[model samples]
Target: MRKWFIERAPDRDVLLKSRWLAPVASRLAPATIWQFNRRSIARGLALGLFVGFILPIGQIILAVLFAASIRANILIASAATLITNPLTFPPIYYAAYRTGTFLLDLVGGARAAQTIAAAQPTGIWTSLSATSLSTFVGLLVFATLSSILAFAAVHLAWRVSLIWRWRRRGGTDRAVTRPTIHQEPPSV
Candidate 1:
């Protein structure tokens, strides 16, 4: 699984050459940022999911920056932001707005929100203050929960994969190598 991805990912130089990535090329030089380890990939996925869920714009750019700062897998971070692409955007935003409305209503802010929305007409891309705020709150909640869930899922999957591979090779006992202690000296 790992090898398949490593084979398909763009080279460091290739990414550096792209105009969009050129400005931050200096920060991308660290080998650790591109590593395929469980921790890095998990962090990358979490970051991507968080940004993707929270922000309507600049998801990839933001994910890249976050991934670089956290030393996550950049490719994974970039790819994970696809969770909020065109096909999925409507449902996600609609759900987020509804969730925010419910939470606000539960906390006694629904009247104020409804009054504000009713007072003004909102465009497709832009909305009144109250509506936007509700959506933002909902997005924040979604982003936090989803990121946490994604991180845990990645780690769990990786653990399962490792156990499966070990079992396939032989058994759990064979997967571990205990350190050997020198009990006696051997004569040559």
Candidate 2:
């Protein structure tokens, strides 16, 4: 899985040559931000998840900025931010709106809930209205929780993989190093 991910991920050269990223190339310290360590990868995933959930536009840039600020893996951050792509956007946003509305109704009362329900968000532009405070709150909650989960998951996976490899190697080494009978000469 790790090898597959590494093979499929965009290398530094590809990212550097990207026309969309050229403007910010100077600002990004590629080596520092692209290193693949537990902390960097976990943080990058978290940042990417957070930005991906909150903003529809400029997600890549936001992920890059967040990754750069925290010295996380830039490639992973950029890739992970694709969580909110076209196919997944509507459902995620709708769920967020519903979650927000529910929370607001619970906290504020029926009036606030009615207001959010009354404002029909036909498009992305209309969705950002101040009238729909529930949507914003819901997004914030979703983003925060998603980021935290992503970070923990990455960290846990890394640790589990390391342990699995270590245990497998220990068993394999014992079997390989075991003494064998010297009966080849008799057979010949």
Candidate 3:
């Protein structure tokens, strides 16, 4: 499954040579960031998830930098940030805003709730009014939770895959190695 997925993913060389990334090719060590491993992949995923939610633009650039700094897989980090792409961004941000508003209201009482309700945000880039504050706080919370969950999920999936492969091969190996009694055919 992993091999299949990797095969279908964008090639490291192709991405590096692309016009948009060619200028920064010197800074990107494809080998270091492209290799697949448990630690690197998990860290990359976490970094991607966190950055994806926090920054709507330049997510790939930020992910690559973060992955390189943390010795994680840059490709994975860049790809993982797609979680907040156009198709899913609205819902995620809305949920984050709602969550932030709820928490603020819970902690700050009706006055805070009323304040947040009064400010109608035209978009994500609006001023830091009550509504925006709650939205920001909620985004932070959601990013944190998503990062942690993504890391854990990757680790869990890796472990499970390893165990499954081991069990499968173990059974086959035993079957192949087990002695099979043979008797000469009765003399005819």
Candidate 4:
């Protein structure tokens, strides 16, 4: 798992030489960003989801920047941004728009969406309306709630897994190792 995070994060050597990352280079150089711990992983995953959901583009860079500032796992944050890729983009946006519209209505200021069809349909980008404000609001709300939920979920799951592992190890705090296949020497 640590190796997985290491492979995703930017190398320390590369950070010192990159012009784009120069501003945050010194901060990211420390092993803190690469630490495979609970808080970092949780923060990284939550930060990545928040940035990815809130913005359609620049998710990876934004995740990295936020992770660096917040002391989250840089690589995990970067990888988590993939949650909002091409395949999942449209549906997620549409859902966010709907959520926003619903929330706005509940706020007692329902903005009636007027769709003046311009020789084309808006598809599922909205709730059958032309209201970008609602979508934006929904995105903001969605991002916040999602990130919070993700953070809690990660922490809870981490604790549960640890307990499960400890129990499986005969109620002891021992690292379980998988058995390796024994290879017999060939007769010369």
Number of the top candidate by lDDT?
Answer: 1
lDDT of 2 by residue, 32-132 (tens): 78778899989988998888888889998889987898899877888888998999988988888888878777787546545654677565554456435
Q: Indicate whether candidate 1 or candidate 4 has the larger TM-score.
A: 1
lDDT comparing candidate 3 with the true structure: 0.82
Candidate 3 lDDT by residue in tens digits, 94-129: 898889878877888535556555576454444346
* Candidate 3 wrong stretches, greater than 4 Å: 17-19, 109-128, 175-188
Model 1 stretches astray by more than 4 angstroms = 115-127, 172-188
The segments of candidate 2 whose C-alpha lies over 4 angstroms from its true place after superposition are: 17-22, 113-131, 173-188
Tell me the tens digit of each residue's lDDT in model 1 across 1-188: 67998999989887888898778888887888899999999999999999899888999998998899999999999999999999999898888888888889889786776676667776553355667777787888999999999999999999999888877877546547533475455569
Q: In terms of lDDT, which candidate is stronger, 1 or 4?
A: 1
- What's each prediction's clash count? 0, 0, 0, 0
TM-score of 4: 0.73
Which ranges in model 4 have alpha carbons more than 4 Å from their true place? 1-10, 14-20, 112-130, 172-188
Residue pairs of candidate 1 with colliding backbone atoms? none
Every candidate's lDDT: 0.86, 0.81, 0.82, 0.80
How high is the lDDT of residue 139 in model 3? 87
